[model samples]
Target: MSRLVVVSNRVSLPDEHGSPPPGGMAIALSAALQRRHGLWMGWSGKVKAGEDPSGPISRREARGISYALTDLSQTDLDDYYYGFANRVLWPVFHCRVDLAEYSEARMSGYQRVNRLFAKLLQPLISDDDVIWVHDYHLIPLAKELRNLGCGNKIGFFLHIPWPAADILFTVPHYDDLLRGLSCYDLVGFHTDDDLSNFAECLRRQGLPDPITNGVCQAYGRVFRCGVFPIGIDTAEFERLAEQAARSETLQEPSQRIPGCKVAIGVDRLDYSKGIEKRIVAFDRFLRSNDHRIGKTQLLQITPKSRTEIPAYLAMQKDVAERVGRVDGELGTIDWMPVHYINRSVGPSELAGLYRMARVGLVTPLRDGMNLVAKEYVAAQDPQNPGVLVLSRFAGAARELGGAILVNPYDPEAMARAIEEALDMQLDERIDRWRAMIGRLREYNVYRWCDDFLLGLDQR
Candidate 1:
């Protein structure tokens, strides 16, 4: 078997006691790495004040897999990570063209960092290793590696939405980014729509289309692009939910909001998440029916993210204020309409909450694949499953057909959908849950990992 080399923007390392990372993707990738006796390489999530960004790499090992990490200087973090990756790539990919702040320095920094990564990683690559690069932050890594005379079969998977040609054209040197992707042997997206959008971008630029059996010719290079919808560890999450449902931790939270059917929303505090709009819809739901005010509760669990970015900082404040405004108006002395939590919650507790809720609200404005939607489906009680009110714009909407899909931009429609979820019959809920869970069980995170790697290997 060939060794697998996984590279992402940040590496998820195990704890001091040698416990694996928390996320399903982390667990699945680590298992694959262990199976191949492979290497996982990326930024260490550390920054030295004035050190060279191309400094020595840090090496560690656990569970038969080698972990390689490198520290970046503060300037590298600011420009490459905070500047181009977040400010330019994130918003544009999410279809928020107005918010994309582009600059020559940021673009140069992004390229410089990719080159630095290639330089540090070039020596470590064995001839037989299959390289897998991840996310928007490292789009140019394959190109950089090829420039360094590495001939490994490299693949890239984008963990975010790929917008239309018009949206992508707003970015400077967009063609250059496309050429960077051409360097990879294979490119993967979350949904067919995203893949089509990528193909459209290529078509508009007069490059060969990937729509013809997923193969494309661009920049004098041949590559394959395909849809690989990511999934969670469904069985493991289901077990966690089952255990958590029986615990006292679930009981305490239920007692606080007596006689109210719970509707839950979990997201990182990002503008693309539509946290504000979701709150508005919840508020609209409350106002549209006076009798339902004390009868229902919306539990919004949003942890802060990307605080360094100006847009994210502003969104954090906006979401908080919107939550407070809704609570103040609709919340009575006995019951608050919206329970807004600004910090992170443990996975076990989250699973318990998902099980407890009557409705799972996952209404992101734009997303790669909202795993919370899947997690909610997996964590549900099979006998009496909760209805998932999902966003049509989310990539998960393609797979989770049983969800009550609504446009995130339309609060009225979302409010109506939430009402429908709350009022859905037990038989119908079970049917919907069954439709989603069956797909999830068969095509899980491990399956996704194998599929992507298999594609790369075939190429």
Candidate 2:
């Protein structure tokens, strides 16, 4: 078997205790690397001035897998990561063209970082190594490696939505990004809509249509594009939920809100998450079902991210204000309608909370897969599972058809969905949960990893 090389914006190295990183994607990728005795390389999540960006890679070995990390300079972090990748690609890909801040300097910095990554990585690559690059931050990596005369079979996976040509064209030098994708042996997206949108981008650029057979001819090379909806480590999460249900910690939250039903929403504090919209819907739900006012509570757990960005900071304030308004408008002395926690919850505690909730609200304005939806389903009780009120825009909505889908933009519809979920019967909940859990059991994160690698190998 050929050696595997995995690269991404940030590396998830195991801690000193040898415990693997959190999150299903990290665990799945780490497992895959171990199986192939692979090399995993990425930025070290450190920034310092005067240190060489292309300095000798920091190397480590753990559990039969080699890990390589490189630190970025402050300028590289600002222009490449914060500037182009977050401000430009993230917004444009999420169909927020108005938010994309494009600049020639940022674009140049993005390209320069990719080149630096390639320069640092090329010497470590074996001739037979199969390279797998992850996310928008590293889209130009394969192109840079090819420029450096490396021909290893490289694959790229976009973990976010791929916007249509009109939306993508909002960025300057969009052609460069498309051409960079063409350098890959395989390009993967989270959903058919994303894959189709990518194909349309190619067609609008006068390239041959790739939709017919998933083969594209562009920039004097041919590559394949396909959909690979990501999944979670369902069984592990299920076990966590089970353990949490039995633990004393679950009693603490339940005791605080005695005789009340909980609806949980967990997400990173990002604009695309629709946290404010969800809060509005929850408020509406409370108003419509006045009898259940004091009996129903929404526990929204959101952890802050990318605090340096102005848009994110503004959104954080907006969401906080919205939460406060909802609580003040609907709360009595003994009951608050919305309990907003702006911090991360540990995996065990999160699973317990999911299990405790009577409804799981995962309404994202736009999301690649929204693994929180899957995790919510996985953490449910089989006998009397909680209802999942999901957003139709999420890629997970396609697979988790058992969820009560609602448009995130429509507060009324979402409020109705929430009511329906709360009023759902035991038998119906079991059947719906069965429909989703069966699919999850069959196509877990490990299976997703295998399918993509198999596709890359075949290519």
Candidate 3:
């Protein structure tokens, strides 16, 4: 069995020994790691310093996979994580061009952390181990690994949108970023547009130019670029939904939205999500069509995210005001145009929510690949599936064409798309669901891992 080493920003703290398993982004990657029960590496989320952070501090086994974690001090958490990674790269990568905060100190800290990660894992890494890294937080990890004279198959996948080269140019150090990415044997993005944007950046940064099929040969290594849109575990999500549908939580809502079609939108409360804009679009949707008052209900589940950031704080206030104003204008005592719910939901309940919805509204201004959109398709009823109103800006839009594509920035357009989805026929809805599911089932997470690994092997 070939060992697979997985790295991420943080590891979930296991509670009881018999828990199902820690399965998030990294754990999903652990399926590939299961053949060898390879090590999963990441920060333990505990603040510390002056200690040997180079070695694994803990270990656990679950679902035929093993996890290892280490602690990072307050300084590292500030500079390496909150300061550099989140405060800078996260906003920039998500296309908030104006909100980027460039700091030389943060950049240096970012580099140090990558080097630390590489140093800690280097000894544990065997020749047969494949290192699969995830997210923007670890972009320079492979470079650090390579710099230490460690040669192994390293593959990277970005879970967030890769901004257009023009937007990326806002950073003072765009060149350095791509230079780090070039170290990976295989680099994966969520869609062709993201790959194009990245490849465009590589060209501008004087990095090795990708040939005909987005292949770039440089540093005595063949870099294979690919667009592998991420997906949820469909069978598992469906099962959870089925179980949730029978729960009292879902039953309460069944009676709550009486005699009206429900449109559902679930997203983290973040600036990039455009939650305020979504509410405004829903307001337009209600104002334009008065008959919809008692006929249509918009269910928005916005769980708070990055609450500590000032920009995010302002966005939350803006969304609240927008939602309130819309309700004040269009909502009657018997019918509220928007049923807004703020806070996180377990996956089990999201499945039920998807089933009850008439439309899955995922219109992020820019998203790498919104898993919610794909999860919605997975939880649909083939006999009478709900419509997916997706943003053209999301990476999933490239593969899930059956979705009712809309530009989220355009309020009027989004409003019309919502109305159209609610009024769609069963056959058309089924056709669209089938097409979307075809792509989803075919290019699932399993296939995504396989494709990325194969590309890495060739390099």
lDDT of 2 by residue, 149-237 (tens): 99999999999999988998888999999999999999999999998898899899887665568887888899998889899999999
TM-score ranking of the models = 1, 2, 3
Tell me the whole-model lDDT of each prediction, alpha carbons only. Answer: 0.92, 0.92, 0.81
Cα TM-score per model: 0.99, 0.98, 0.93
Model 1: how far residue 344 lies from native, Å? 0.5
lDDT of 1 at 285: 91
Candidate 2's TM-score = 0.98
- Assess the local accuracy of residue 208 in candidate 3 as a C-alpha lDDT between 0 and 100: 56
Output the lDDT of residue 371, model 2. Answer: 95
Ranking by lDDT: 1, 2, 3
In the range 89-124, model 1's lDDT, one tens digit per residue, is: 999999899999999999999999999899999999
Q: Which portions of model 1 miss their true places by more than 4 Å?
A: 208-211
Residue by residue across 327-418, what tens digits does model 3's lDDT show? 88877888888888889877877888888898899999888888889999988877889999999988888889999999999999999999
